[model samples]
Target: MSSETHEFKAEVAALLNLVTNSLYTNSEIFLRELISNAADALDKARFQALVDTSLDGQELESQILITVDKQAGTLTIEDTGIGMTREETAQNLGTIAHSGTLRYLEEMQRARAAGESSGAVEPNLIGQFGVGFYSAFMVADEVVVTTLSGKPGSEAVVWRSRGDGSYQVEPGSRSQRGTTIVLTLKTEAKEFLDRWRIEALVKRYSNYVMHPIRLRVIDEQGEDKDPEPRQINAASAIWARSSSELEDSDYTEFYKHVMGGFVMPGDEPFARLHFTADAPIQFHALLFVPGRAPADLFQEDRKALQLYARRVLVVENCDTLLPQYLRFVRGVVDSQDLPLNVSREMLQEHKSLAAIRRQLTRKTLKLLAELAEESADKYAKMWNEFGSVIKEGLHTDGGQRAELTELLRYRHVADTDDGLVSLKDYVAGMGEDQKYIWYVAGPNEAALRNSPHLEAVRAKGEDVLLMSDPVDEWVLQSLSEYEGKSFRSVTQGELDEPAEDEDIDDKDDDSDDKDDEAKAKDKREPSPIDPLLNLAKVVLGDRVRDVRASKRLTESPSCLVDAAGGLSRNMERILRMAQPGTKLGASPRILELNPDHPFVTAASKISETNKDDPRLAEWVEILHDIAALAEGTVPDPAGAAKRFTKVLNNLVAG
Candidate 1:
C-alpha cells in the first residue's frame, strides 16, 4: 500500500509545538499519558464486544505491555485493546483536545436519549483530553504507532510523525487487534530506557489501573532469560471494590500505598470514611484520618488527597479536593465526573469538582461526629492529635460551624484531671443565670485554669472553658456562638454580675431600711478606690482606655480587658506574632483593679494621701505590666523591670 503524507492544520501545528514543549511539566508524564490512552482503548473494546460478538480482540485478555530496548535506546508500549482505523487515527491524534472517549460517551448519551440504547452500560475510560497522546513528543525524537482495529474486517494502519507539524499514514499488516506505540528516545531522555525507571513511572501514575500493566526488559545479553512479561501495577482498584469484601488489613495496605508510607508501618488510621455516592456525582472514596499528624502538616504548601479518574491517577496531591483545614486527611478519591486539561496533571475549575468537594467535606465532618458519639476513647485520642487543625474550619467554613462545634473538646476550669468538655455537655450543665458561654485563653491549661478572669465565675460555681491551643485564639474570633448561646471571652468587655436567684419581696416595708443602709455605707466609704482609679488612668495615659474596679476579679490585683466589641488580648498577640509590625494589633485595652487586694488598698491610700506621690505612679505602672504578663504579652519590658526593682527595694526597706 502507498504511504500518504499530510501537514497539520495551522492551529494544530501551533498546538503541537505547545504539547511537545510546554504542555507537560515532567518528561516522565509521557509514559502515564500513553498508558492511560492504552487503558481507554481497552475499555472501549470490552464495551464494544458486549454488543458486537465479531470483534477481533474479544478472545484475548486485555492488558498493557511495556518493553525497553536499552541497546536500541527505544521503548515500546503495546496493548490488547481497540485500535484506530486510518481516518480515526488522523482525526483523533492530529488534533488537540479531541477526545475519543468523550465522543463515545456523547454517542451513548444520544443513543439513550433516542431510545436506541438499553440499561446503564457505560464505558469507564480515561484520557479526556486527546492531547495526552501528543505528550510523547516531550521525550521522543520520532514516534510510530501501529494499530489494527478490533472491527472484524478492519485492516491495520500505521501512523508516523516526527512532531514537526507533519504526519504520515500507511497500511499495516498486523494480524492481532490493538495498538503499539514505539518511541525513539532523544539523547537526554534515554533514562526512560532503564527497566527500573519504567517500573517507577508506572507505579507512580497508573498503579491502580483496571487492567494489568506488564513490563519486559531486554538487556545487552539479549532476551534469553525472563521470557514472561511480569505485571508491574497492582491493577486492583481497591477503592472501586465492594467494601463488604475488603478486610481491615486490605484497607490499611491500600492507605499505606496511597499515602506513600507517610504513616508508620503498623500504625492504623484513627478513623476511616468509606462510602460511594451516586446521586450528586458518581464517586468512590476511601478517606483516612491518620493517628498522628505529619510535622509539616501546617505548612502552607502541604497537599492532601489523591484524585483519580476511573482508576488512573489525575493528580497526586489534589489540594482543591479538600480545604486547607482538612489537609491532614489522607486517602484516595476516584471519580469520572472531573474534567482534566491536556496533561491531566491539573483539574479544570468545573462545577462538578465543587460539588464533589462539598460532598466530601460534609461526609468527613459527619464521620468525625459519629466517631465522637460512638467511640469516646478513640475519638478523644484522635481529637488530641487533630483538634487544632479542625478548629480552623470553624473560622473558614461558616456553613459548617454548627457541625464543627459539636466536635470541639476543651479543658474545663473545674476539671482536676485531663478530661475534656464538649459544647453540648457544657451547655447542658449551665446554670439558669448563666447567659453566655464563658471561655478563657492562655499559654497553657494550668495558666488558663488559674486565670484571674474566671475567679468570680468560679465563686458562683460556674464553669469556664480553658483553651491553650494557639489556633484557639483565631478560632474564637469567628465562632461567636454555639447552640443559641452567645460566646463571651472572660477577659473581654465589662464583666457582668451574675443575676441573683433569690426573689425580692414585693412588700414596701423593708425597702426604706435597705435604702438607709446603702446610703450610710456610701457616705462612710466615699469611694476611696475612686481616687486610685482616676490617678491610674492619668498615669497610664492612652496605654489603657480606662481604669476601673473589676467585678470579675477576686484574687489577682489587676487584669486587662478589651473594650466592648474590641479584639481580645490573646487574639491580638497571635496576630502580632504571625504578622510582625501589623497595626491591627495596636488597640488599647481597659485595665481593671481588684480594690479588695492588699496592693490595690495600699496604692489607693498612697493616692488619697497625695496624688503626686512617686510610689503611687510606680505601683500603677507595675500593676499594668503584671497584667500584660498575665495575658501572655510584654508591653514594655525595660520600663517594667526598673519599676519592679524600685518596688522590691522599697518593700525591703519598709
Candidate 2:
C-alpha cells in the first residue's frame, strides 16, 4: 500500500491553525482529548452490544489502552468500541464533524452582536467546534488515526494529518473494532513519551472516565530482562465506593488527585455532599464546596466542575455537572447511564442531566444547612470563605433560594457581640409584630454596629442583621424576600412602627422634665441655622441628591444614609473597584445629628446670637464638614481648612 498526502479544505486549514496555535496552551490536553474520545467510542460500543450481542461475537470487553514509546517518540490511544467506517473517519476527522467549531463560531457571532468585546468572549468558546481532535497539533508534528467500524466486513481506515492545514485518508487493516490515535511527538513535546508523564496526565485528566484506561508502563521488578507494558489507571470509580470506607484524608487526597494540587490536611471543605441516585439517571457524585472561594470563582473566565464517567475520566473540567453559580464547588461526578458521546449542547438540553443537576444542587445546599446546624463554628468559617457564593445562589436559583436563605448567616443585634447568626435564629428572636427582616449594610462589623439606622430597632430590643460582606447588598437585591418575610435595608427605607407595648414613654414626671430638657437641647431651632444647612446642601447639591435632619442619630453628631434606590457606602466602593469608569448615582443622604449633643446646642446658640459673625458662619460650615466625615464622605479640605482657621482666630481673640 502506498502512503499519500492531500491538501485540507480552506476552513480545515483555519481550524487546524487555530487548534495548533491558539486553541490550547497546554500540550498534555492532547492526551486527555484523545483518551476521552476513545472512552466515548468504547461507551458507544457497549451500548450497541447491549442491543445486539452478536456484532462482536465475543462478549463486549470495554477498555481504553494507551501506549507510549519513549525511544520512538510516539504515543498511542486505542479503544475497543463501536468503531467508525471509512466515510465516518473522513467525516469525523478529515473535517470537523464532531468538533463544535460551527456552533462555536455561531456563538462568537452572537456574543459579538451582544456587544461583548473579542477579548472578553474568547476563553468561553470551547467544545462546540470539532477542532478538539486537532488540538493534537499543539504538541505533535504529525498525527495518524486508525479506526475500524464495529460492523463486520467494514474496512479499517487511517487518517493522517500534519500540524499544517492538510490531511490524507487511506484504507488499513485491523483485527478488532474501535479507534486508535497515534501522535508522533515533536522534539519539544518528548516529555509525553515518558511513562511517568503519561501516567500522571492520565490520572489528572482521565481518572474518572467510565471505561478502564490502561497505560503501557514498564512493570518495575527486582530483576528485569525486558520491560513489559502494564496498565496505570485506578480502573474503578471512586464515587461508587461506600462513604464509610473513605476517610477525610482519603477524600482530600482524591480531590488532590483529580484537582492536581497538594490539598492540605488542615484545609476543611466548606461543604461536602456524597450521594448516589438511580432514578432520573444512574450517577454517583462527591461534590465539595471549598473552604475558601477560588480567586477565579468571580473571575469572568470561570472553570467548570470535573466530569467523570464510571471510574475512568472523560472530561477533565466539565461544566455540565452544575450551574455557573456553583462553580466554586470542586469534585467528581460519575454517571453510568448517560451517553458517552453526549454533546455540550445536548448536555444543556438533556432532561435527565437537568434532573441530576437539580438533585445535586439541593444536596449541596442541604449539606451546607447541615453544616450550619451541626457545627456553627465550622459553618461560620465556611461562610467567611464562601457565603458570598451561596448568597449568589440565593439570588439566582429560585427553586433552591429558600433553602439557601436558611443557610445564610449575618451579624444581628442579639448576635452582634457573640458573632454570626442565621436567619432562622433571627426569626426565632423576632418580636411578635416584626413583619420585615431588617439588616444594615456597611463596610465592616464596626460600621454596621455604629450605624444610626439601627438605633430604633435596637431600642425595641429587635435584632438587625449586619451585612458586611461586599457581596451582601447585591445578594439582598437578588433575594428580595425570604420565607415570606420581606427583607428591608434599615438604612435605605422607613421602618414600620415598633411593637405597641414597646413604645417609648415617660413613666415619671421627672422623666417628662428630662424629655423636655433633652428635646430643647437636641432640636435644631428654626432660624438662620436652617439656611446654613440648606447652604451646605446647595454647595454639595448634585454630589448629594438631598440632605435633611436625621431622626436616627443618637451619639454621633451626624451620619449618612443612602438616598432612595442607591447603593450604600460600602456597596458603592465595591462597584467602583469591579467596574472601572461606571458612573454611580448621586444619592442624597440624610444628615443626621444628635439633637441633644453639646456641639449642636452650642452651634445653634452661637448662630442665633451672632448672625453676622463671619466666625460663627465659619463654625456652622465646620459643623457640616464634621458631619460629612462621620457619614464617610470627605469634605473639601481647602474649605474646611479656611473655616478651621477662622474659628481658631475667633477663639484666640475671645
Candidate 3:
C-alpha cells in the first residue's frame, strides 16, 4: 500500500474529537451524512456534464450502494459520483476548508450574543457545517475513502483517517468514476454491520435522496435457502405525489418519519399546507402546524424550520425557510432549483432562494387565511396554540399585514356573549356612519368588559372589539388601519364622531318650561368637592401622569390610560421575556376617577373638611391602587395593605 502522511489543523483536530466523541447522541446519523455527501458529489457531476458536452455521454449511474459485511464487521457505502484527487482528498479531509467549522463557531458567537445558551455540542450539525463526511467517525473507528475523479487524466486517491489528529492520502486504483467509503465499525457499533439495521436507517433518513440506495443483504427464500442483495430505498420525491392519493394517515406517517418518530399518542397536526411552485423556483412543500406547541418553541435557543433539497432532508429545523415568527411551522421544502453543495453563506445571498422564500411565506399566510375561513372552530383552536405567531407576522410583515388582519379574530361585546368574532364579521354589521374600527386591550374578557374606556362607545350603541390576548397590543400597534378605516384604541386616542351622532336635540316649548325649572334646581345644587380629587392627583404625581373627572367612567370608580405612546402592561411582560434585562422607556398613565362612585364621593367630602387629614392621604392612595389594578399594573402592596388595614380597623371600631 502506498501512503502519504498529512497533519490536520489544530481546530480540525478539535472538531474531529468533538464529532467522534462528544457531538452526536445518535450514531445512525452517520449514514445520512454519507448519503448527503454522495448526493452532493452526484449533483456536481451532473452540473459539470451539462457545461461540458464531452462528459455528457459518460454513463453516470448516480446511485448509492451500501454493503454490510457481518463477518468482516465493516460497512461500506459506494457512490457513482464525482470523486476527489489526491490533493483534494488531503485538503478536504485533513483541513477544515470545505467543512463549516469556522462558520459554525461564528454562528455560536452570534447566538451567545443574543443571550442563547447552546448547551451541548451538536454532531448532527455536521450537515449544516458542510463537513458531513467526517460524521463517519461517530460510529467507525477508522474510515477509508477511495475516490476516482471524473477528470480525463486525474489519478485516483485513497484517504484514510482514524479519529486522530492526522490522516494519510495516497495514490489509489479504482475502475469507476466515483467514491467508496469503508467504515471499520467499532465493537459497540457492530449493529451497523447488520443488513436489516442498515437498510432501515437508509429508508428512515436517506429515502428521499434523489439517488437509488441499494443494500447488500440476504433475503430468505426458504428454510435452507441463502439470502440475496436488493435495493431498499425508493429514491423519489415523496412530496411530489398527488394529494388525492395521499391519505391523512399517509401524511401523518410521513410526518412521524421526518420528525424522528416522536409522535405523541393523541396529537394530530392542527393544519397542513401542501403545494408546489415552479415559476421563480421549482419547489414542493408540505407544511404542518403542530397540534401542540413544542416545548422548545419558547426556548431561547430554539431550532428553526426544516429545509430539504430534491427530497433529501438537508437541515433539520432550518430557520431560513420562514421568519422566526413562523417558528411553530413544521415541514419540508424540497427545491430542485437550489444548488446542492451551496454553503449557508451562499444560501443567504442566492437570489432565486430568496424569491422562493418570499413565495413560500405568502403561500403559508394564504393557507392560514383559508383555514380561518373554512372552519372557524378548528381555526380558533389553532389560533389558541399559534395565533400569537400569526399576530407577530401581522406586526412584522407589512406586505401581508392586510391579509393577516382579515384573518384576525377577536371577542366583541356581541360575540363575547357567544365569544370571538372575525373582523370581517364585525365589519359586516357596522352602522353606516361607523368609519373607525374600535378595539380595547386588557388582561381578560371580564376586565375588558368592565373597562370604563368602553362607556362612550357603548353610549352611542357602538360595539368595541375586546382584545384580551397578550399579542393584541403589538398587533394593533403595527396594524394602524385596515380596509381604508383607521383602528382606534378606545383607551388611548380622542374619540372623533360626526356632529349629528353627538348632538342632543333642544327641548320644545312645553318641555323648555320644565328644563328651566330643572336648571334653576341644578344651580341651587352644591358643586362637586374638587379639592379631594386635586389632592389625590398631587399626592400620586410620581405614580400617575394625571387625575381627572372621567366622562367615560360609568360603573368603575377609576380606570387607567397610557399617558403617551408605548406598550401596555401585557406587552411589557412579553417584551421582557423575549429580551431579558432590556430596559424600556416608561410611559406615564392617566388615572380617571368616576365622580358618581361612592368611594370618590366620600373622598371628595373628606378632603373638603380634612384637607390635611392623614385619612384623606390614605383615601387618595386607595384610589390610585384601584386604578393600578384596573390597568393591570402592580400597585404599592405595602402602602395599599396598610391603608386597607386601617379601613378595616375603623369599621371594626365603629
Relative to the true structure, how large is the alpha-carbon lDDT of every model? Answer: 0.83, 0.67, 0.71
Top model by TM-score, which number?
Answer: 1
Q: Sort every candidate by lDDT, greatest first.
A: 1, 3, 2
Q: Give residue 504's error in model 3 in angstroms.
A: 23
Q: lDDT of model 1 at residue 71?
A: 72
lDDT per residue (tens digit) for residues 455-492 in model 3: 87787777899887777877876877666666766776
Judged by whole-model lDDT over C-alpha atoms, candidate 3 comes out at 0.71
**lDDT score at residue 120, model 1, on the 0-100 scale:** 42
Q: What TM-score would you give candidate 3 relative to the actual structure?
A: 0.68
Residue ranges of candidate 2 with Cα displaced over 4 Å = 1-67, 70-191, 208-226, 310-312, 339-349, 416-418, 433-436, 480-486, 492-550, 562-579, 583-585, 641-654
Native-vs-model 1 lDDT? 0.83
Identify the superior model by lDDT, candidate 1 or candidate 3.
Answer: 1
TM-score against truth, every candidate: 0.88, 0.69, 0.68
